[model samples]
Structure formats: C-alpha cells, structure tokens
Target: MRVTLPASGTEVDVKSLSRTNAKRLGEINSKIAVKLAAAKADGVTEEERKSAAEELKALLDEKEAMIAALYPDLDFEALPNRDVLALIAMTVDYSLNVPEAEIKNWIRSGNGEQTQAA
Candidate 1:
C-alpha cells in the first residue's frame, strides 16, 4: 500500500505484516493500552504516571520499529508526529480495506456540523 504523508507529502510504500509480526504488533498495542489505562486510573501517583509515560514511550518505539520493518524507505523517526500519525492511519485503513467515504465520515463525526451564531 502507498500513502502520502500529510505534512511532507512524501509517498511511502507499506507492506502488510506477516502473521508473526502482526502478533507482535498486537502485543505492543495491548501493552500500550494497559499502560494508558494505568496512567488514567483514579488516584494514580505522580511517580506511577511517570512510569506509565516511560512505558508508553517504549511501546511507541516498538511500534516504530515494526513500521520501519514494513516500510524500509520511510524515515519514520524523522517525520513530524502529525505525518507519522497520518501515515499510520492510512496504512491501517488500506490494510483493513476501509472505504474512503468511511474514513471521511469518521473524520466528520469528530466535529459534526458547524453553526454560526445569529
């Protein structure tokens, strides 16, 4: 799958992960979710929050490694975060065979219709 970076407009070629790599990706995602939940739980201490942040950063690094393996030409670390996020979203959308209209609808759902004050 080919996707254009949102900020730089650079095109990237992404490959679907093999079953083993996909499993690794799923594990990384699960770890991230657990860390996020810990960080957000009520009565969390500052130290615990910091620990969660570090864990989340490590998980993000793992995810970047997976993405780099799939898209060797992409300098994933150097790209702006916005572009990286856009690239990830596009890659997942393509991998899942999501329609463009569905993506547009999802984006629209975030903001709904805007109205002007009378």
Candidate 2:
C-alpha cells in the first residue's frame, strides 16, 4: 500500500507486517506496558523509576527500528513531526487492517467513540 506523508507529501510504499513481525510488535508493546507499570507502581523507588525509564527508551528504540524496516525508504529524521506521526498512524492502520472511517472517528473523538452533546 502507498501512503502520502501529511506534511511532506512524500509517497511511501508500505507492506503489511508478516506474522513474525506482528508478533514482535506485540511483544514490544507488552514490554513497554510492563515498564510503564513498573514506573507507576506504588512504593517504586527513584532508582527503579530511572531503570524503567531507561528500559522504556531502549524498547522504543527497538520499536523505531522495526518501523524503519517496515518503511525502508522513509527518512524519519528529515520528516516534519506531523509527517512522522502520520506515517506511524498509517503503519498501524495498515498493519491492523483498521477501517479508515474508524480511524477518522478515533481522531475526531479522541477516544474512538463519538460524543453526544448534552
């Protein structure tokens, strides 16, 4: 599939994640959740918090590497922040096969459900 960056309009060719890659992504997300939980746990020491932060950083680096591999031609460092985010969103949408309308609703409602006025 092809996605155009929101800011730069650079067209990127993206492939759906293979089973192995999707599993790896799930593992990465689980690790991040663990690190976040550790950081937020009651009676967490300062040293423990710092360690969790460092671990989270490393996990994020790995995730970024995976994303780079997925979008090989996309130059993330040179892209504007909005473009970078758009690419990530595109990746999620493509990888999960999420409907475009659902994504738009998520963006509109900020929590994936529409709000009714009082």
Candidate 3:
C-alpha cells in the first residue's frame, strides 16, 4: 500500500519495509512516545501544555530522519508534519510483525473502535 508523506509529495510503499526498517522505526518511536507522554504528564496548565506541545513538535525531525534512513532515496529533511509520516511508518512496521487479529485488537485498545479489514 502507498502512504504519502504529509506536506510533501513523497510516497512510501508501506508493505516494502524490511526487518531492519521496522527495528529502526521501533527504536525511534519509543523515544518519541516517551517525550510525548512526559509532555502530557507534566501536570501543567492547558496553555503550558500547548507551549510544550509546540516545542515537542521538533521531535518530528527525528521521525523524518528515521524515514530517510529506511528510504535513502527519499529526501524528507524539509518535509512538514514528519510525525504523521512517522506514525504511518510505525503502523506499517507493526502490521508486518503481527497477525491481522492482533492488529485489530491493538487498534481497538487505542481508539475504542473495531478496525475494518486491511
């Protein structure tokens, strides 16, 4: 399947990722998750959280960097919304490592709704 990078014209073949790509994505996403969780759990006011979120958007560069690593041919260094693209990468990677049923369970746990067939 094709996954297009947000704010950029580049596209990635989601199903073409290799084990190495998945591992790299997992490592990078783990770090991103930590930062995001910490930002949300800091007990700050809404305005403060908004400020923190703006700062946290910088992490999108790291996500784009990982994608560039997986696809050397792509130049995503200047792309916008790297975090969104990175998320798509993670979903594709996770899908490859699990069965359809497990993916469905995972999605339901996240958004509290059953996922449609892939």
Candidate 4:
C-alpha cells in the first residue's frame, strides 16, 4: 500500500493492507501520487504550495477530530506539535492501510514548516 505523508512529498509503499480495503487504498494512493507529482514536476507556485500545506494540515485536523469523536478514550489535544504531526501521519497511513512505521518515520523527518523561495 502506498501512503502519502503530508509533511513530505515522498510516497512510500509498504506491504500491509487488508484485502477488503486494498483497492480503495490504491485509489487514494493514486490521487496523492498525482497531486504530488504535479506539484513536483510543474513546480508548485508559492501560493499553491502554501495552500497545499494548509490543506494537508486541515485534512489532518479533520481526521484527528473524527478519530477523537469515535474514540473518546483517546486524548487528541494534549500531544506536542511533533507528536501530533506523527499521530496524524500515522492515522492517515492507517486509513490508507499502509505501514505505520514508515509513515511515522517520514513525519518524524519532515520539517513541517514553509520556507519561502528567494
């Protein structure tokens, strides 16, 4: 399964997905692959790049909220920024049914900050 790490543009494929969800996971992977590839190849405009990062954060937040709602026992508000990013990446990786460890590693290595091009 291929999981897109929002913090980084790299798409990683890992062998871990339930047979039932594998197809859906492939669709998601393709979508992310296209978006990242377009941005990489065409060179995302400054504004578009900012928008992408914001969109990623918003998506992560939405997923986090959903998880919190479904699992009331889990505390989602108390984690540090890095941990929160890691958690979000992990959740996304899981939702896509990919390898959580690879996603976590990618998130851990990400800068998570926008740097303007000079």
What local lDDT does model 3 show for residue 31? 67
Compute the lDDT for candidate 2.
0.72
What tens-digit string does per-residue lDDT give for candidate 1 at 32-92?
Answer: 9989998999999999999899989998887777666677777877888887776666555
Candidate 4 lDDT for residue 53: 65
Model 4 spans > 4 angstroms off:
1-34, 80-118
TM-score rank order? 2, 1, 3, 4
Candidates in order: C-alpha RMSD to true structure: 6.6, 5.3, 8.0, 12.2
Cα-based lDDT at residue 2, candidate 1: 44
lDDT of 2 by residue, 47-75 (tens): 99999999999988877777777776777
* Highest lDDT model number: 2
Candidate 4 structure quality by residue, lDDT tens digits, 44-90: 79888676666655644554565444335445565455544554456
User: How good is model 3 by TM-score?
Assistant: 0.41
**Every candidate's lDDT:** 0.68, 0.72, 0.55, 0.51
Which runs in model 3 stand beyond 4 Å of their true positions? 1-15, 42-59, 77-118
Candidate 3 lDDT over residue span 1-118, tens digit each:
3444444545555444567866765766676787677767857688866765765576556555555565566554445655345545445655466553454354332322455657
Off by over 4 Å in 1: 97-118
- Residue 99, model 4, lDDT: 51
